[model samples]
Target chain A: MENKLKRKMLWLDAWDIEEQEAWFSHMSLQGWKLIGISKWMAEFEKCEPQKVNYRCDVFKLNDKSENNRIEFYKQSGWEHIATRGFIQVFRDMKGDNSLEIHTDPIEQAATLSILKQDITKRGILTLLLSVITLMLIVGAHQIDPVGNYLNDKFIETIVLIIAYMSISITMVNGMIHMSKLMKRLKSGSLLEHEKSYHRKIKRNKVVGITVIFILSLWVLTVFLNLMNSLQEDRFPAIPKTELPIVQMADFIDDFTYIDEEGLSYFKENSSFLVPRQYQLEQMVEVPGETWEDNSDIYSPSISSFGYEVRSEWLAKKFVQDLKEKHTYYAENYVKVPESKFDELWLSQGNFNAAFIARKHNKVYRVLYYGKGSIDEIIERALAKAER
Target chain B: MANDQRAPMTEAMYYVLLALYNPLHGYAVMDEVKKVSNGRIIMGPGTLYGILKRMQQENFIVLDELDGRRKIYHITENGREALKHEHQRLTCMVDDGKPLLGNGDSNGK
Candidate 1:
């Protein structure tokens, strides 16, 4: 005879002893006898449809007397089916009159003490992890809130927070259920067998599916990041044109675009929160300019980064962020109230002049290293942004 | 004071101790406990195992030998002392109750 097997993914709390036993019994009645069990799955073999009793007991797996204990149960006519962590499942036919594994409720509660202690330890560890995750998020925001928003780290942080909170919630929920089970057993009530598990199964299904969905989302985010890193063009062969970013030619006349190795390039990237990002680093020089004439090798270089955000509000905030970032090099940023763009802030520095501007749903920053009025650079940047 | 931790022995623990008087293995202890209790206390394998392990930890019992996978245990002196005290305590309680309940034979009717 050919033996058939089936596997099921189940999410039953270990402390929910009655529900686990009842569920196994229910499966047996449906002609699927449990053959194996692990943390997240149960393996079943096809058998004749018959009523049977399933019982779960907790015993330390590493105990020296574990084999003796199992042998004792077998002598009493209970067949050990599977062991998952400290939990051991046993089965017997309904009318066999086999000795119950735990006749005394209080004694059974003694066996559950080990499980309770294990859960308490896990609960404490999980709580610590959750607190650390929360602190990381708060620290990241406190250090550079605006920078995180602009660099697309805000979404990743939110996802990490959700993942930790979900795990914490699940752990706390399991602790609560275990406490209830312990209370009942301590009160000398035998754990009910063959109870209805429909509600518990439904609830577990929802929780399991939600956990899987969150895990998949996190994995997808990480995979996409890896792929983007591999596909990013670090050094372009030729200069890109028609880009919606400020270029050196827009501000300088009769300048040669510097195509030096590893000095200048155009790059693009995107994220879920903000799509359509562009970074440009272009160095330009006059026809007669040379390093001998000017100590600086790369003169009149334009390094600009821009983003076409999904909303005007985001662009407004991004412009402020750009200004704050540039304030490190330039002592202060003076607002250009009557600019061609929606908003603009020009850096107040002699060596490296910069301007941050926003128009509708677009935000950009341009840094110039030359001896020219920053107003011309700002005007050209605004013109390009408006176009 | 040495037996303070095991001063108040549970019914199951007391019966298990009594069963270990003859150096019985795990399953044999369960059978003996049921027989000595006149079939009133059908000790489950789980309960028997827990009591045996705890007794061994408290030095109330010692593993005498290992017959295949069966562990035969014998009661220690500490176990005997605890059982003796528990028996005295139970006897005192029954004696005290006899005055109010007519020796537990009149059925209070």
Candidate 2:
């Protein structure tokens, strides 16, 4: 068989497709006769460096010395590197094959290390970008009014809930899948073996974006609806026309408003009056009797009218009073009986105005009326003097 | 079975060397191994490339660069020596077992 000049082939760990092709061309240029090429599996199978059969293609070139061939493989960038498996050499036996030579393949334990080097930078960036996208979605939820809408309404709530679940799943799954891909890179597993994983990433992106967009839209819709509801309930627009609005709890007597414009004007004016009467009224209802007995003046006009009062102006006044010795309407002083002030503030719009008398000292006070009987107002005024 | 267990040559190494003993390229060698092993040992393409590189380094084989895609290889003198040693070791053990069995001829009647 040696004298017959049969095809000779070598298998090596670093022999990728392109290198092998280039090597083949180089040998052809050197006047080696081309023969039928076959794969080199038998030799690798016996070596079994990775506890599995090693398979490699063997290109048979005739009229080439074995020494020159090995040199060719090395010089052509097909040099043996440490690998998990082995490489083998073979000859075309034709009819009767003989075992001519064999050697253990190089221990390519470092291929995994090289492969990881190739992918680490890109892999980390991809993971980082994914995390940023997740953070943006979470940040969006915090800033927009969508969360409240999702909680309150039906369609939007359901959609947001589903979106939340989907996004969370996609984010978690994508990270897990990506981590697995990184592990494979570290392990020196072939890229071809991991090709099917790309589709999973794509699917996750699609699902995640869909979920985020839907949730964002749901949140936006809910915010708009809330604004509309508030506008409708609080200060709805009315055309100029004659309409009767009877006096309710806020008026001293049953007064009729014939003009819609006038009613709107009155309600707008009501906002202004709400603060004036209620501000000093709360100070009189101080929780402790000691402070009440010590003070001379008190007022509870806001509570008598039965209006739901808010004390934004009053709170501002207090702040201003703290800074300045006196505000525009009243002098600043640290009123005792803080708990009484809280109760009076909470129920100011419903308490009888006659009962509220501003007490400045132990024996001094000023009486005021807010939709109360004249007799009650006179009695409260006289009682203040007696105190 | 005990002797099999003591085998120095692994199945992958044995089969890969066997596959390359024929005139073949990377894919062709893989197919040959699969066929011979009845698909029990299917060599992936990447694995095949890795093995080809390692074998070429140890002087066990030499690459034939005449073909572009299929880089062929052949066994070397040193490779042959190792293969022969393995073969002789198995052969001697088989020969030693002959004494225990009646292998005179004619089906040992």
Candidate 3:
């Protein structure tokens, strides 16, 4: 085993078979014999700097036949150095002119097509899937912005989409190069010209590292934000009742009036994961506010839940859930789809009336029990959210 | 021409089969080709192995022997037939050019 070892980062496209072989040959002349290749990294065993011919081939094969291929190449004075995926790299100390596996340009092109074929087939499928996933995320944001905001899986989904797109672009780029090389071969271009990947390899390494750095920073920022939010009450208070989502309350036809004590206002701004949420729950002290309130008086109060959503998708989702859970049918439950806001008028249900509206980024979800129509109580709350 | 199905053979294929007629390993074939062509044609290991593998699979060549890491290959009857047909094609072109160029031309002036 050679004690001295070195590694190099490279981005070898499928058509780069010629370049990889040339680079390997050049490396051997500097006493570094390639020992292994894994994705972007190439490992070499250092030795006495000597002129040696090296070649890399790309082909699909099963393990059993691969053994035979390796054995055959070995028998031909070629030492198998490293294999990464479809690439097989070999080195030989034989005369520089005595190392080509395929002398015929036509044959060379045919063999190189193996990689092109694989990428063409699989790249299209992968590209299609990635595109579809991206479209789904866009649609999700449009359908319900609020739920999508609270969706903790957004970061992972975006990362996966980006990665898939990168892989897809690489595959497409490889295929394009393959076609160009094949065309040049068909039109009589020397194989030696495209054999030096020095500059390209350096550029690829920089790009690869830059992309990895950016992705790492993206994930790290989210993780750090989550950690910070978990450690401390991050967001500032929702500001003194400078404006409340719930202003006043009243009953419907029975003329149920407000308790005049002013609604009890409770404000909370909290965060879980990386997202922050502001919740404002105001209890309208009606004739029978709660089971205890009902025992004390006929004040049938409605507990309203409102949120200052961070995004449009989250706001949309909040409105959607409110409509699904609270809206009922028949005379007791009248659906008002044409209302200025998303409204449902009710006279006898658990929620006498439910009004869901979104102004800018803020969301208002009012479930009214004792109300003489949603306007009597929530008009001021709506005004506040609108403001 | 004999098979009618095999595409026109390339110079590399021709020399490879020609070199294998005497049973040679991949490196030897490369050297043999350069030697025969007077250093005009040089075959690399990648092209050498590719031709050998394809020829063997197509029955134009066969594994003659395996000595350690050197696998010696010999041209098969199919390889010989293919080479013979290529020879005929080249011969016709040479013969047809004989009258036009004047064999040993400078003397004709």
Per-candidate DockQ values are 0.67, 0.03, 0.43
Off by over 4 Å in 2: A1-165, A168-387, B1-10, B21-23, B34-69, B73-109
TM-score of chain B of 1: 0.87
Q: Please provide, for model 1 over A250-292, each residue's C-alpha lDDT reduced to its tens digit, 9 standing for 90 to 100.
A: 7666776666786678888776546888888877767765554
Candidate 2 per-residue lDDT, tens place, B15-84, comes to: 6777777667655776787787787876543345556666677777787766564567777786676566
Give me the candidate number with maximum TM-score.
1
The sequence of per-residue lDDT tens digits that candidate 1 reaches over residues B1-109 is 2334545888999999988888887788888999999998898888888888888999999986665555678899988988898888888878888877877778568
Q: In angstroms, give how far residue A282 of model 2 lies from its true place.
A: 23
Per-residue lDDT of A182-203 in model 2, one digit per residue for the tens? 4554465432311232344356
The candidate that achieves the highest lDDT relative to the unseen native structure? 1
Q: How good is the docking of model 1, as DockQ?
A: 0.67
Residue A296 CA displacement from its true place in model 2, Å: 30
